[model samples]
Target: MERRKFLKDVLKAGVGVTAGLTVGSALSFASQGKIELPLPYVKLDPKKVADRAYDGYYEHECAYGVFNAVIGELQRKVGGPYLGIPTLMFWYGGGGAAGWGTLCGTLNAAGAIFNLTCKQKDFKAMIDTLYEWYQTTPLPTYIPCKGNWCKQPFPKGVSHSPLCHVSVQRWCKNASVYFGRPILYNSKERSERCARLSATVAAKVVEMLNDYHFGNFKPHKVKGSQKTKMDCRLCHEVTMKELS
Candidate 1:
C-alpha cells in the first residue's frame, strides 16, 4: 500500500509538472499579447475527427474524449500554440460532471471547442444548433467498431434533452438494459454506444468548424412558438422574446 501510494503521488506530481509546462508555454505566448482568445482553427477532416473521438472514449470517457480528439488533431495539424492546451482538464465533464449526469459531456465538449475556436458572437449560435441536433437526431449512427468491440447487437435512441442521464436513459430504454449503477452503465454495449455517439458529435463539431473556417457556417433559427410544447410558454412568451 505504501508503494502504491508513493507511485500514485509520483504520477500526480508528473502530471502537475506536465500541466505546468503546457500552461506555461501558453501563458508565455499570451504575455507577448500577439495571440488572442478563440485561437486559430484550420479545416479538419470530419472522418478523422470521428475516428479519434471513437478511440478516445475508451481512454478518457466522453468529454475529454471529444475535447482531446479535436484539440489533439489541431495540435497535430497546426502546432504553433495548440500544443499548449491542457486537454486533460476536460475529464471532469465525463459522466455528466463526474456521474451527476447533467449536460451530455459530448455536447459540453463541443460547446467548449466552439468557444475556443469560433467568435464569441457566433459560438452560442453554433451551440444552439448543435444542442438541437443532439436533441433530435438518432444517435450512435457512426459506429467505428461494427463487429469487433460491439459483438452483441446494440440499439440507438433520440435524446429529446441534452442532459446526459436523459440521453443515456433513452438509449438504455431502447436497448432494454438497466440504467443504474456503474456496472450496468459501464456495460460493454452501452459503453460502445456512447463511444459512437462521441464520434458522431465530434464529427459534427469538426464539420461545423470546417464550415466556419471556410465561411459556410449558418446558425439555425427556431421560432419561439415552435421551441416547445409546454404551456409555460404562454406565460413566458414575453420573457422568452426578451432573452432571445
Candidate 2:
C-alpha cells in the first residue's frame, strides 16, 4: 500500500500514521506472512513521555501539538524518524481534519506516532483505547504549570463521536460556554483543552508501545470503533424478540 493510504487507513481505523522518510533504522514486522518495514522508534517511559508531549501541546496546537510533543521526547535521547518532518504542515488537522472537522487532530497525531514506531497490529489495541478514552473521558486533562487557565475549571464532557466538530460541540454543551460566542472554533480555552488532550494521547501511546515492547499490552475487545454506526455493525445479525 502507498504511504498516504497506509497512514489514512491506519489512522481512520485508529492511526497516520505520519508519512515521511526516516533517518533511523527501520524495523520490520511480520504481517500476514509478509515482511514489512516501518518507521523507527526507541523504548520510553509512558507517563514521562506523555508529560513531555503535554508540554509541547502548549508550544504548538493540535496536530503540531502532539506531533511536537512526541518528537520532542524522541529527539532528547534518540533521533531518526523525526529528523526531517515539517512542523507547521499538519496543523491543518485543526477543527477536525484540516479545518474540515473530520477526525480529531490529536488522534491524527497519535496515528502518526504508531505508524512511525509500531506495527499495524498494534494500532487497533493502542489507538482503539486512545479513541475510546477520548470519546468517554473529560478532555483538557492536562493543565499548564503556568497559566490562568491552569486554575480555571475545565468542564467534563464525553463526545459520542470523534469528529472535531462534535467533540468540541459536546464540550461546549457540557461547559455551557459556546452557546453564544463571537467565534467558536478559536479560543484560549479550547486550545488549552486540546493541548492537554494531545499530551494525554501521546502519553497513552507511549505506554501502550512500551507494553507492546514488554509483552504486557492488551488490545480492547470492543469492535466497530470510531465510526458512525460502524459499517461492520451494519451487517450484524440480530436475535428475534418476543412478539405479540
Candidate 3:
C-alpha cells in the first residue's frame, strides 16, 4: 500500500512540474508583447514587437510616400538647402509610380529613415555603402514563391529563390547611426528581421530611381514595336559603376 501511494505522489509531482513550465513560457511570451501569427513564408511566427526606434511621424500612405518623408527629413537635418525636394520629386515621380521591382519597399523605407537621421546629402552613396556592409552579414533564406511577398511562380518552372533579409537589417543599422539613437524593437532578433524587410523594399525603389535617372529611355528600335528600347539593366550597370 505504501509503494502504491509513493507512485501516485510521483505522478502528481510530474504533472505539477509540467504545468509550471507551461505557465512560465506563456508568461514570458506575454511580457514580450509577442502575438504569434503563422506567416505563410516564414517557418517561425515573427514576434510582433513594438518598435521603439524613432518617435517620428508614422503615416498610412503607400510605401513610397513614407520613404520620401523619411528622406526629406534626413536631407533637411543634414543642411540640404531645400529639404531634398529635388531628390524626393525625382524618386516619387519616376520610381514609385513606375514600380520597378529591383529593391524591396522595406529597404527603401529604411534608407529614407537613415537619410533623415544621418542628415546625409548623397542618399545613393549611403545606400551603396550599406549594401556593401549587408553582403557580409548572414541573412534568412526563404523559398521565393512561398513567402508573404511572392506567391506566384516565375514564367519558367523554377521554384522560388532565397530572399535576403540581412540587407534590410544593415539599412536599419545605418539609420540608427544617422539618428544618433537606438530604435529598440521587441527583441534584437525581431528588430533584425524587420530591418531586413524594410531595407529590401527600399533597395528595389533605389534600383528604379537609378534606372529613371540614368537609363536611356527612348523609342523602340524595331519598326511598329510597342515597347520602348530602353535597357534598364544596362543603365543600372552603368550607374552603379559610376557610383562605385
lDDT of 2 at 109: 80
lDDT of 1 by residue, 1-244 (tens): 4744564465557556755778978677768876566887877888888999988888888998899999999876665457778888889888898889988899999988998898878888888888888888888788674448555444678887788988888787777643333335667777888899989999999988888788777876443345652234323555755655
After superposing candidate 1 on the true structure, give the runs of residues whose Cα lies further than 4 Å from its correct spot: 1-35, 145-147, 150-153, 177-184, 221-244
TM-score for candidate 3: 0.24
Error of 3 at 168 (Å): 11
Q: Pick out the ten consecutive residues of candidate 3 with the lowest summed lDDT.
A: 38-47
Mark the 10 consecutive residues where model 1 has the least summed lDDT.
Answer: 228-237
Which parts of model 2 are misplaced by more than 4 Å?
A: 1-36, 45-55, 177-184, 225-244
Instruction: List, residue by residue over 1-244, the lDDT tens digit for candidate 3.
Output: 4744564465547556645778888678768976332111101111111111111112221244435433443343332232324444333322223344344333445455444333234444545444433344443222122234245321111112111232333444554554556533333433334333333334433333334334532211121113422233433456656543
Who wins the lDDT comparison? 1
Model 2 lDDT at residue 226: 55
